[model samples]
Structures are given as C-alpha cells and as structure tokens.
Target: MTVDLIAVVPRNSRGRGVQRYYDAQSECAFFVSEPSGQPELWHRYLDGARDVYRRFGVEQALEYDAVADGASTSLFFAALNADGDMVAGTRIQGPYTDARQAHALVEWAGRAGADDLRRMIADRIPYGVIEAKGAWVARDAAHRAELGAAISRTVLHGARLLGARYGLATVASFTVPRHEACGAMPAERIPAVPYPDERYRTVPLWWDTRGYSAFAEESQRFSTQAEQDALGLTAVRPLDARCGAGRAAESRRGHGR
Candidate 1:
C-alpha cells in the first residue's frame, strides 16, 4: 500500500538552498526551501499559491503581501511535474508561542467559534504548534488527488522536521476528508466559519504529530512514515539569520513555543 519512491536530493553545497523530494510513482518532484535560501523557487511557490487563490476567489484571504517576504514562514514546499512546472505547494509557519499568533485567530475574530478556536491553539502552543497554509494544486495537473495526498504527507514531514508536536490547517469543508486521511482532525466543537465569504465553510483542523498514526489512513500511515524517515537523513537548513534572531528575541521575551 505504500510506495517507497520518495528521495531527498540536496540542491546546494551548503545544504541551505533547496531540498528536492522526487516521488517516482507520481513522477513529481517536491522542493522545500526558505525564502532567503532559495529566493527564486520561493517566489515560484508564492506565485503559484496566489494564482490558485485568485482562481478560487479567495485571493483576499491569502494575505499574499504579509507572506511575500517569507519572514513569517519557516519553510516552503513546492511540488513540480516531471517537466519542471510547479503543480502544488504549501508553507509552514510557526511553532508559535501564543494562540493569538495563529492566522485562524484573526480569521475567526468577531466570528462564531473564535473563542474556542483560540483555546484550541493555546492548548497546543505549549506542545509546539505549526500552521500549514497557502496550500494549493494546479487546476490542470494530472493525478491531482495523488499529488494532494503527497502534499498532505508533507505536512507531517514538515511538522516532524520542525520539532512541532502539533500542526494546524484551516481548510474549506470539502477538503476536510482529504486532510483527515492524513491524520488531520477537525475541531468540531468549534462551528465552521464562512471565511473569505459565505461561499465556503472553513474549519480548523489539527494534526497531532506524536499520535497521527492512530488516525491516519493505512496508506498514509506507511507513506508519511516513510517520508518522515527520509527527511530525517536530509540536512534541512535553518531559518534565515534575521529570522533566527527574531525567534531568539521572541524566546527571550518569554514567548517561545
């Protein structure tokens, strides 16, 4: 049920530029990079995410400007076709110090379930929490479902790599099943919010990195575990120096997660 086709290839001598993950079964290559480490690819990811958001009529919700410089992002994940065109991607933000740091707090502000959403994040912050955002897939990409599954696995891989105990994602109602397959559970106690407009009902989902296998689908369990194992051997680079300093300062201020 699991394919052992994912391999990580370092894209730079210093191990800081980009790390490529090639999935032979899908013939799709996934790249993980920091904005400062590989600006070009980082921009590609931003552009791709923007395009997807625009087409979905949720561009405003994306808050592109806020993440353009990638100061708030810990890592970027891009999935490219064999022809080298990016088809899907997502980004990781945090290991947050406070519940208010989650984008959901802002999105749910003055809306239904805002308080419960805040509580959910606050409870996880002490365990180390990261948010997976800007996730998208090209409309015309082949094997879209398979690619989506791969991207979900990246959430697990990323959370583990970043030392996060939990991961958060706010997704449209329809996408909940896909994420759930990869061990993301909806915060059902908090009513779903009509975000970016009433056209969609968005719900907050959480991934307990330490116990995901208990809920993840069989194939996902094997594949995510395989990918996480592979990532363990890869030398993922640290955040940009300025970003590192900022994190240090936040920690010193007693805001560390």
Candidate 2:
C-alpha cells in the first residue's frame, strides 16, 4: 500500500566521515546505493538475509545469477544502527522488458506451471514493472514494524522513480501482513498460494505505483499528530542522487528481466 514518504522530517548525520541520513520510519541511519561499489557491505547484509532464510529452511542461498542480476541492475536499501552495522535490507530489480525475463517470476511460474500467470504479466508489459526480492532483518533489531515499513516504501518509491507502474514480490506468508501495510496485494487471482518451495511457501504479490491513494487512507488511521509523525518518512529522498547514479549506470550496462 503506497507508503507516504513525506510523512517524516529527515535529519542528516555526519559519522565516521561518511555521509548518512536518519530514516524516521525505520528509526535507523542508512545509506542507499548500488551493490557494485559496495561489495563488502552488500554481502554483509546478504549474509544476514541468508541466515534468516536458513532459519526457515527455505531458500538458504542466492544463486550466482541472482547476485549478478543485483550487482548489475539493482538498488540496495539498507538500514543501519549507530555502529554502522547493517541490520536489515532489501533489493529491487528492473523495469523489465517482459515477464519472461524478469527476476524470479519466470522460474517461479515454470516451477508452478503457472502459464496463465506468465501470460497475465506479459499482457501488462506496456506498464513497466520491477521485482522486489531478498528482504531480511537482522535477528536482533528494534522496532521491527517500522523497519519493515521503511524497506517496503524504499522499494516502492525506488520503482516509481524508475518509471515502473508496479512492483512485484514473492513474499513468505509471515511477511504478508507487513506487505499489506505497505499496500501490496496479491498479484494472482488467489491471494496466497502454496509456492513450489514447500519450505517457505512464499506467495506472489504486487502493488500499483500509478496514482496510488493508500497514503491518504493510512494517514487517517492515526489519532494524534505525534502518532502520525512516528509513522511518517521521507520516502523518496533516500533514492536520490547517489542511488540514481548507481541504477543509471547499471541500466546503461544492460537490460534484463
């Protein structure tokens, strides 16, 4: 559900001589950029995500292709604590040419024999789309709700900035509530389905980027100004200059699903 990025007033911080900004929604200081130039940082977060995936006995590791895809054409939205430790993060891939070439969708459909799913996505090709994947939070992070919300909006806003009409994700059942809070709904006719991976049972979902109104709806749910402020965020700003340059360079490198 399209998160309101402008809900929070952001403040800048200077630490370790590294430029950083505070994300009120996530309640953590962070830096958002591409993975290529930040290999160690990227892998550190990936390791955390991998650990989470392992605990569930689901997909425990990322394939080479997945890593290459991310390094070549994805943005990293990471949440960091005061010690500059990345506690949670997520990756987003493309404004793709078609469904067949997009990340995870094609293989997932093939595994599930979801030809109709593929066709539905192909039909919507005229409207640009992106896939959100590899989201994970450190085992010990405070304000988990706010961190999830922060990651959700970061990917949503990132997709919008790249001119995508929608953002897609294959999320685990447990994570559906968080996605719903961010305005993500089922991409399939059935809201949640058994994924081919019996371990995780992740379900496909998507959120509209064009003319979304959930921000207005969500804003009204809060009673006082303080409550509202706590849930607010400067949504799109994190994906500003530095983030753009990375994606722009990756886009120039090549285009893939």
Candidate 3:
C-alpha cells in the first residue's frame, strides 16, 4: 500500500528465467514472463484475474479456455505481496498480424462500432500493435489505487519490450481515468459498448508508445522511464523487422485488417 517504491530488481531466475522487479510505492514485487513457459505463474495470473472478474460480476467476459491455452499471450505481468500471493496482473496478447486477431474486434462484431474498431487496429498494425488484457488487482490489497497505477504502467513496459509501438485495451468506463494517467487515451470518436450484459460501458483505449511520455503524469513518466532503464532499453526501438515485413505483405494482399 506504500507509494515510496524502490528500484526494479531481478529477484530470481526460476520459471524459465522469469524476471522480477520491486515496486516500493506499492510494496509489491512484479514478475514478468512468457505464460506458456511458466505454468505455475500462468495459473496464478489466471486465478487472480478470475477472482477479481467474478467479484465485479463480469466473469462471463473472460474466456477461460482461450486464456488458459496461453498460445496468444506474448508477455505476462504479475505483482505479488511480501507473503508471495499474487495481487495484480495483466497479459500482452500480440504484435498481431491481423486486426481481427484482437479480442476487442471480436467483442465488437455485430455492433455499431465494429468497423471503426477494426480500422483503428489495422492502421496501427504496421507500427506494431498489442492488446493488453486480463488486467486485475485483488480487492483486498492495500493501496489499491497506487497498486493499480503501477499495474497500468506495465502496459507501456510490456509493449516496449515486445517492440510494439501501439497498445490497445477495452476497459470499463470507471477505470478510464486510471489508465489515462499512464498515457492511455480513450477512442472518443467511437461509442462505448455495453458488454458482458450492459452493467458496464466498455470503451476502447489506445497508447501510442512513441509519445506517451508527453501525456503521462510526471510520477508515472519517471517510474516508466526508470523501469525501462532497468531493462536496459535506452530508447524505444522501431517495430520488429519481422513484424514490419509480414505486415507489408499482408497489406499488399489486402489482409492487413
């Protein structure tokens, strides 16, 4: 629950060389790894997400099997307390080759803004796009807001590590401002969607990795830059060459979207 955080440090090399960092502000240790390769950690993340989603009465929105398979997840982030319980987490889905590959597009299908959502993702595909999903924090955790903010910053961290220039998220209206503090902007032109039975108005949010620093809060900017520096990334690299080449071919075939 504390906000006076320490520097990011790698605590161990277990779980297929899982990376760990400390957040003094939140009083928690954060872990990053590939989902499929770390079965124990992967299950911990799934369980934590499921518990939080169920508490919010939006458990139906989660696709358990799809998430469990871990085939599409490129990076997973988890936060644990001193006692070693998973407290907060999120996963990055892809530097996708197709717009339809995003769960948001699937959730928007048959809806009014479906096309707009597709186009939004398609336009960013060539620049490297990733969907940050399954984000959650335990309700009983101390310093909930601070912890949540810390988790939000990981979206940018994960995107940069994966060579992604843009990241997308479909978050409930209430959490919009929290994400925005970390540089996510709502797609205001598109109307909100009533998802998981209408109790929630979910809207699409995007982060332009190249310029998020200009919009992020000062503390957030400092924290993000510190984390990136710890990872040895002096600057944001361009989209991975493989992703660029593949997208070019996909665009030529009119399948980029």
Candidate 4:
C-alpha cells in the first residue's frame, strides 16, 4: 500500500499497520511520485508553513513582514498521524512577490545564477529558512526517535528533489532547539533559533545533507571548533567537470542529484 502526504506524493508504498502516523513497511518505506502539478504542491507547502512560524527559530512577524514586502516561492509541509492529525508544520521559503505566480520568477532567477546568500531573501528570492510550527512527536522516547528519522527521510527527500530541478547549489535553514517546547521562542537576540536543537531533533540533520552543499560563504556559520565538528561539515574541492568547458552544467547536475 502507498500513503500520499499533502499530495506532493501521489502514492507511497508501505506495509500496513499505522505507527507514528506512517504505515509500517517492514521498516522500509518510500514516498510515491508527486501526484499533482509541482506548483500546487509548492503553494500548499507555503500555506501550511505560514500558519505557525514564530516558535521554530523562525520569526513569524519577520517572515510575514517579508511576505508583505514582496515574497515569492517557498516550501511548506505538514506531518500527520494515522488519523491525519497534524504532527508538525513547516515552510522553507523561496522568494516572495505580490504577483501570484512570481514564485516561478524567483526560481528562474536562482537558476539563472543569482547570489544565494544575499539575493535569496524572502522578499526578493526565496525564503532561506524552514520553520516548524505546532510540532509534536510520540511521547515515548523510542517513538520520538523514530519520528525524527521519518522526518529526516521525508523532509530531506522533498527538499533535495526540489533543489535538484532548480539548479540550486545549496540550502540554508533556521532550526529550533531540540528539547524546547514546540512553541518555544528562538534563543537569539534576532529572536529565533537556528534549527530544531540537536537533542530533540537529530544532532546533524539527517536529511538534505546528502543532496546539496552548504553555500560555504554564508551558511549557518560556526565559530568554535566544537560547533564545527558537531555539524560534521568539511571543505572539499570543486568537481572535476568544473575545470572543463563542456561539462560544467553536467557536473553540477550530477552533484545535485
């Protein structure tokens, strides 16, 4: 049997017996193809994220303010229980614009080679951060662990899929603390958290890391050696194709997938 979440997937195959909102498939599960058009899924994702943005290191007021200013494309999603109860809500933004379809313009701009750290704002390009709102996991410690893993697989897969098609080289996010209550405010003076903390959420985000590279120049910067080590990030040389003329696009394309 297959389970579709938010229609981004048309059918995902798995075994029966609902646990933690996802059907068990002998411990192996997969998402079905996106049933609907991609644009609709993108909008649906953004709407869900907008519903609750404040608690997750994401500043609702700031994000909305950016939207009002001129936001474009964004990513949004929800995790649900077997009863279809919402377990968590979040959105990763792209760009914002008053025009209803301006999000596509933002995508074009990014693929055309715009500055990621600077141009990719909620108002001008796309929202950089992914925010979780009203998030919950099974109360049992064991169940919670599984819940995090599921989220990692799903979210990472979703983001990577999007980034690959768009020619995006990197992804940036704002995570919240792991153990803080779902509604906890971000700890920084900027009034947000970086991402879900390592304790509650997995220490290194187990998703997305496999697909895109950090922007390097402007990623969530770490000052201390400990912070650097914890994120498990390292610098590597550019791809071999980048050195040659005819293969730059192909090289980047291969790296993205």
Of the candidates shown, which would achieve the greatest lDDT relative to the real structure? 3
Ranking by lDDT: 3, 1, 2, 4
TM-score of each: 0.83, 0.69, 0.85, 0.32
Query: Of the candidates numbered 3 and 4, which has the greater lDDT value?
Result: 3
Q: Candidate 2, residues 1-257: lDDT per residue as tens digits?
A: 22233221123321121222456555676555566645555666677777776775655334434574355446666677655667788777787786876655543653553665576567667878787777877767877877776666655555665677677777777886776666566554433445535555566766655322332136322211222233243232221224455754343222212
Estimate, for each residue in 1-257, the C-alpha lDDT of model 1 and write its tens digit.
Answer: 22222332324423465666565545677778777886767788889989999998899987899899999999888887766677889999987998988998887899888887887788777778899889989999988998888887777777776788778888889988998888777775778888879999988888766556555688887777666655654433322334555653442232112
Clash pairs detected, candidate 3: 2-25, 3-25, 5-24, 5-25, 6-24
Task: Kindly provide the TM-score of model 1 when superposed on the true structure, using C-alpha atoms.
Answer: 0.83
Model 2 / residue 174 / CA error / Å: 3.1
lDDT value, residue 134 of candidate 3: 90
| Clashing residue pairs found in predicted model 2 | 1-182, 1-183, 1-184, 5-233, 5-235, 8-233, 101-257, 102-257
How close is each model in CA RMSD to the real structure?
Answer: 9.9, 11.1, 7.5, 13.6
- lDDT for predicted candidate 3 compared with the true structure: 0.78
Candidate-wise lDDT, in order: 0.75, 0.57, 0.78, 0.30
Off by over 4 Å in 2: 1-21, 64-72, 110-113, 190-193, 215-257
Q: Could you tell which candidate, 1 or 4, scores higher by lDDT? A: 1
Highest TM-score scorer: 3
lDDT of 4 by residue, 1-257 (tens): 33344332323423122112232421222222221223333333344445444444444422454543223323333454443333433333322232233222232233322232223222322422232222223332233444443443333333333442121211123332321111112111121122333223121121122322222111121211122232232432333544454564454343322
The predicted structure with the larger TM-score, 2 or 3, is: 3
